[model samples]
Target: MSVEVRAVPGESLSFPGRITRVAPPRTHWAPVYRRRVVVADVVAVVGSTLFAYALRFGNAHAHPVQALLLLGLVPVAWLAALFVFRAYERRFMGLGNEEYDRVLQASVFTLALVGTTSWAFQLEIARGYVIIALPLGMFTILLLRYAMRKWLHGQRDRGLHMQSLLVVGHRQGVLAMVRQISRASYHGMRVVGVCLPPAADGRLGVEERALAALGVPVLGGLDEAADVSVSAGVDAVAVLPTPEVDGAFLRRLGWALEETHADLFVAPAVTEVVGPRVAIRPVCGLPLLHLERPELTGFRRLVKGTFDRVASGVGVLVLAPVLVGIALAIKADSRGPVFFRQERVGLEGRTFGMLKFRSMVVDAEARLRDLAASSEGNAVLFKMKDDPRVTRVGRVLRRLSLDELPQLFNVLLGHMSLVGPRPPLAREVAVYGDDARRKLLVKPGLTGLWQINGRSDLDWDESVRLDLRYVENWSFGFDFMILWKTLGAVVRSRGAY
Candidate 1:
């Protein structure tokens, strides 16, 4: 492939093609490498299934014929579901938690299919075998994928197996494209240079300076893009849109790249639409992108809510003894009720009394006025890293997060969630600006971004940012991730007390 190199005013030799290269600071790899990683995942799933069977059912007592049949059936069913689900598509293979999610989904679907088929045919499949194999196999496959991802990240960190890209677009588009590619280095792309299309003004925009800060070279204006690509040795050219460029210019740019043997990528202006939600249609030489919203209502919400309640209820039951111990400790250390109830905003701006084990003295609120002047809390809230109101046992409760256990009841009562934005106090909610009010759009959580991030350490702005991001990106999978991280955060207790 061709690439172009150009020297900017103060930057070193700019190989715009080097943006696509796997070296030094850039960690993104070629698209082909990502495809191979998916293939590796398929192999891992098969291998993990076999290993799970061998581990669960020892070779001594295992029925060889039954085992062999199951081994063949498992991989075939998994591969079928994965293919039907389009789980191995290149766009989703490299980054995000979606890859792991698909693997789990495919496994669950395969097991359900197997169960239904066994019952329909009256095949007398051993219940114990099915039970042991499904979960064990699923766990093994997920662990394997996690291990593979870690290795891939390590490779990216070492700057191997990356693609060199040439960004061709208006100044703003080029700057945005470069910034995105740079932030996602694990995707394996390096932008070596940019070719800004010709403008009526003949002067590049301030975004060009932004790109220069990223160290990407600016090849001459758009007309010289193909020549620059050839000299710079870039593998791909990413075409970013500008108001100045119409369909005819884009067509010509495509033809130029084709003659140079460089792969062409067109970035659409659409945002917030994920891969699964988008479909492309080509009609009359025009490419139309069809965006479909994921179904998040009716039965889906019911299922999610039911799962949350059932899971949280079981958790409360399992931790009952620990809860009792914490309550007793709080009582012994201070003269107050076991639980503290405060009015906090819930989903859709509804107010509810959030419950937590009292982690401070009985007169904590009465003393708030005295401590306000010396508060270490964020701008919109009052806090103290070393508040005098906190009891001896309260510190321990805060550190291990045992203080929030009583909120499990709130979750069961449908007033809170096992995961969501932290419930805001009445005063905090009252002062929330228009943008910050978005956090009230979802059900408040016992432990959320604010909880796992820093409980009380995050500034008001950072806390609000995390809350809004959680709302905008809410998904069942995301909730599970936050729950998992909450466990780690609780153990570490960083910035908790």
Candidate 2:
């Protein structure tokens, strides 16, 4: 028997009877078998508890009843905690650290609950059993989850067991959503078709055309999306929300999807707000998304600043002998001073004398005007790959980025950070357009996104984009990542001249 389901834009439809038949060739136990993962977790917990019991009580010969009881309760407690923690939800599986975090939390909660219950009920549970079993169960659960995650990731990499999605929204919004999903296939969304909402402009953007060329079907307007989703056999419908998705229309769409068992997903318009930074606060009757502003002050700022100062201070102290040797090398190779200071724009557009160990001739600035016409930099900036102004010692220093080591002092003086936007010269800031001024929103750094990402090799637009992206998405974790990458970039010296 065949059943028909009716769906709408932003809604899902499923028929009462099997809407689609599964062929023998299509059936597999790898990707879509979420039940298998839960079963594996339960078995692993039970097995580990049993082993722990044996290890703690010899062969369980003296306390067979007690060992069996504890092993039996382990699975029960774990399953209960997993359900309470929503660990089995397919939506959260194989994505982000949240899934693993829940597994740990559930294990901890289960162990605590079992311990507390034994004490309160006076069950005379052996301390050896509790001590050994708890850690063993927790470690086993984490290890099993990690192994499952690796297996799932392999499946995703091979394009198996992914959810097929029907994108529905205005042409631009749908196209944007399609591009993002296609680029991040590890997220497990396969865009099967796009349902463009009726609008004045019938033409799709360049992005949409590119997606269409890649064989993603472009279904007609929203009115026809229901039929398309059913025909395409999509598992979910993601509504790429335009400004028009008000509460009333969203509610109605939810009601329409009830007949179809397909899941519904809503993509918000806000960008740069990752899961950790956004909180949904239901004020009165409206769902208000509260985005926590990037904290640049208070305890976090204090900690970051303290870390920067102490780290930079120690770096300078450890590298003092190297610094002295470099200074002597510079003097031996050229007549220039040991260090150079240039006027640069810093935080909030404040002017500062940015210091670096000298890597140019004494008359380099004077010669710059003569060589200005042949400048190879981004036009506004001045750079020459084989400039004659570089001294013998300067060449080595520049290549290894030893020239900027003195900026550790700048970080200690609060004039810079261990990580931030690249400090712009005064001349560069003068030529910056209004949009470019946003780079000064935070303190400039000695090395940053531009430095690690090919440094002088990047075009003007690309450099500015990276800098602004850093400002918008600044986090302590991101800073550490940049720092780690910087070490590798320095070793390669890809863009360091």
Candidate 3:
């Protein structure tokens, strides 16, 4: 069946194609999700208060009802601070790092207020209670929000909580966006229909089957975009790269969609330029996007370096026995050295000896040329799922990535960061593209975006794209997330040979 939306400006109207079987409309879901988060915050705050009270007083019931009442006041005051900071707002609930940032903001603001109040009232607040309760509440709140996000992602994957989108742009742009949005189901955008710009009509060469395969039907031209949007129950009108999606058109489009309570989302042709690097400021009614130069040096780098050193040290210490076991297995299964050291290209094209537990035959490198013609790997890197050179021990080591445990030393030695772009083979760097050379800006990582996304399985272009994306948008939080995701990726053993 069909629902209604608006048209883009100026192309002939045709009977609009429609999307079907969309689960009921979820336009008000953000608020519903926000409410869940609010409830979670309350649970977290209350539990933390009780825990703090117990931790401090040991269930002594020293003042009976008075102590319980005093402890209860903290949660009420904390919730008020969260409300004042707008941490419970719907806009910050589902995407990016903003939710965590808001939670932290609210928590710190509450803590500050608590401290100030205690000082003003000349009441001696127990430091243990303040420290324990604030951290526990914050941790519980973040855990609950993470659960909510996971639940939301699950819903979106099954076509719930998705924003219906009408794409208005060139034929290529519409198709590309449809496919892109389809691939990233967690993005929660469903491109239900498309409206092409008139100038590109002759170049249409549009394949109905290809677009329909993604459940996105093209509905005439840009003139009918608004009408198609309304007909499709579109929640957002995506104006892709096209001259027709200009200032006057967008201004009017915004007005029309506002009446429908639908949003106008514009996408420029450029990709991967996101996060803290981009900002939009209006000048003379034109919204100008400001791009910041990536900072590779200074305090953040020091923070990253310190984190790498400390984390790698702990990892090595904890994994010491596992490392020994792998080395022993390799020694028993094959006639080669337990450790493998290969020259790899690092930051600024410097060469470093990258270490690993040997996960291939001693003559694996010598045998590479013989297998070159039969290589099943992506371009540049050579990999084979059933490579004959891999010993039995090597297979198990590679499967669980136990072979790379020695690289913790690389991270500890200042040769690498715990998370950065993958260290390139010297030969890979030799033929690097101008754009790919940006991967050399930081220390190579023991693991990174490329590693977690798909180790040996990603195509050369995708691998390079991920590396470049990481180089451009390096942040400590991003690194931590990648590291967290790495565990799942390793367990699944996907893309690993």
Candidate with best TM-score? 3
Highest lDDT among the candidates is held by which one?
3
C-alpha lDDT of candidate 1 relative to the true structure: 0.74
Error of 2 at 103 (Å): 1.3
* RMSD (Å) of each candidate, 1 decimal: 6.8, 8.5, 4.5
Which sections of candidate 2 miss by over 4 Å?
1-33, 47-70, 123-136, 198-207, 291-294, 306-497
For all predicted structures, in order, the TM-scores are 0.63, 0.64, 0.85
Model 2, range 66-108, lDDT digits (tens) per residue? 6556877667878789879988777667776677778888988
lDDT of each: 0.74, 0.74, 0.79
lDDT of 3 by residue, 420-440 (tens): 888999889989999999999
Backbone clash numbers for all candidates listed:
24, 2, 15
Better of 2 and 3 by TM-score: 3
Please, what are the lDDT tens digits per residue for candidate 1 over residues 1-497?
Answer: 33344343554442343334322332234455556655665676677666666666666555665666577876788778876776676555656777777877888898889889878887656666677667766676567666766677668767666667988877766776787677557676788777886545545457766776788777667776666666666777887766756687777777766765467787777543444567888878888887675544578667767987998899889999999988888888889799999998898888999888999989999999988899887898887878899999988888888888898888898998888888888889888899799778778887787877777777787788778767666677778889887997899797787
